[model samples]
Target: MAPNPGRLDVGAALSYGFDKFKANAGPWLGITAIVWAVGVAVFIFTFASTLTAAIAAADRGESAAVATTSGVFIVVTAFGTFVSYFVNAAFVRGALDETGGPEKPAFGRFFQLTNVPQIAVLALIWTVLTVVLSFIPFLGTLLTIVFGFLLSFSLTFLLDRNEQAVTAIKSSFDLTVKNFGPLVLLLLALAAINIVGGLLCGLGLLVTIPVSVVAINYAYRVLTGAPVSPAR
Candidate 1:
């Protein structure tokens, strides 16, 4: 096994991510482009549709119309979130596969349809739980963050191990709680990377998104004492 298999090396994780991402920029960039396009399109469409409905309701002085518009907004948002996660599961798979590097990242590998059902269910569960709970007043925000942080590895677990959605979530929570301190630092570092990436006209996300996903997956393997293929 690689030396100190269970040791949390945030720097090493980040480094491996950069190396692999650089080596496989094509697929990563392609994946990012589609996801980015869909996200922007969805945001604009949702905003315009909901805003028009809201304004029309206001002009007509119809409280029922306003409520219906609000409900439509929530549903659209939830659906968008579900689609995002569903697409993101492929990235999770690509990132994790790139970890054990006997093979280079193949564009076709990212679209492997064998795992579709599991990832779809996983995304559905995550979207529903996160969106619904987040609408709560005080406890909502706290619980959402808590769940988000703890279940950060949920998708990774599902992809790497064929874990069911609920089991994956629970396992991720258990694992994260085990090495809380190191993961906290790793999580902060990931946030910083993405934040900086976001500042660059959001174009930086094309680079940062794959790197962060791979880095976090690397960290997961490390924390779980799983073997990582030697970094190329």
Candidate 2:
């Protein structure tokens, strides 16, 4: 629990994640896949509505109206992204807790946890930082990558464990600074899984989501010696 200097053991992390997926692949995948599908549908619906409003404003030759509409669209989009991030974090933490043998998994309860105000604030800060970093040149890309890993680590630590938000964020940052190489690899692996899963018409999401969740959860446990809870 001394911060898993070996956490960068990519093969071990992948294997542990796959093992967890194998154990509860059926139920986890089924639940997560459906949730993801619904999310995609909602996104499409929102986008269509926003686009229609924008076009209507433009047609009216009202520049101010168009600008206001665009602003609203951006705000709505940001809010949706914020909610999605927290919900996903909540689900991953809930799933990890169940698989790590501390609690029984309750999908409904996990979704409900997303309503927590702190999670929204965390998500908003994360989104703003990501957006700002993305606008930078080459250094921006590098910063974004590093920041992303840290953010993921912090979120996992915060949601899955019982640490206060400030403490979790500080600990995650410290761990990332100490193990930058391994943490980078872990982030890359998770990214690859997501890219591939998304490409497979989302069919691969069933496997990828659960596996990635377990892997990150294990990484947190190894790094922090935090007790994993059973499902709530």
Candidate 3:
């Protein structure tokens, strides 16, 4: 498919995403379920004992033990979140195919787990750089937000555009600057949707998460001029 020359429309993209979610709820939810199940299992396996000890140490006013446990937790959580970026690419691709492609893509597309090493390495680079920049007080906050928005589409671009991880990161920042305002609106809207999902005892995520993926991929398609069918 050829890319479209027009820009993204935030509301229209989100509405299209919700529609796709309604149509493909089962498969999307299945993907979410599997991801969460594995995440929870890994968390338990890695941190269950440390977490218990941390809690006990906190009750005993043991600052050293608490700090150690907290630091370990942060590292583990960062690694998990890094891996999730790759997992999220699968969801983005599936959502793109569902909303705009002529035929359905495989439901387990996210689990294909290709390019994992590249994904992880890029993720680590971003994390370390961001963590350092995040320490600069007000300027740090501003830079983080700007880079956050700039790099937001990196994973989707990597998956959909067949770009290398570093190339995708660079492309995301470049394209995002061209359409900064609309993409920021889209990002805020997705964040709001996820906040609502979080409020619904976390079950709303089964719907909102995939919808967010669809919305971002839709923006990626429009901004990059990727060929896609009109959203129903």
Q: How many clashes (backbone N, Cα, C below 3 Å) per candidate? A: 0, 5, 4
Off by more than 4 A, model 2: 1-8, 60-69, 103-109, 112-115, 130-144, 226-232
Residue 89 of model 2, lDDT score = 70
TM-scores of the candidates are: 0.91, 0.78, 0.82
> Compared to the true structure, candidate 2 yields what TM-score?
0.78
lDDT of 1 by residue, 72-108 (tens): 7988888888888867777887877888656877887
| Cα-based lDDT at residue 191, candidate 3 | 95
CA lDDT of every candidate: 0.84, 0.68, 0.77
Q: Model 3 residue 112 lDDT?
A: 67
Give the alpha carbon lDDT tens digit for every residue of 1-232 in model 2: 3432333467777677787677555667666876777688769867886787777777667886678676766666666667677657766656556556544555554554532555666777877776666557899889976676776666666665655556667877888787778767887888898889989997787788887777777666655555543322
Give, for candidate 1, the lowest lDDT window spanning 10 residues.
Answer: 1-10
Candidate 3 lDDT, 1-232, residue by residue in tens? 6655587889998998897778767788889887788778768855885686587677657787778786766676666666666666667668667756786656766566556666776688777766677558899888888887888888776766667879989998898999989988998999999999989999998888888888888887778877766665
Task: Supply candidate 3's per-residue lDDT for 43.
Answer: 82
- Model 1's TM-score against the true structure: 0.91
Best by TM-score: 1
Higher-ranked by lDDT: 2 or 3: 3
When superposed on Cα atoms, how far off is each prediction in RMSD? 2.3, 3.9, 3.3
**What 10-residue stretch in candidate 3 is worst by lDDT?**
108-117
Overall local distance difference test of candidate 2: 0.68
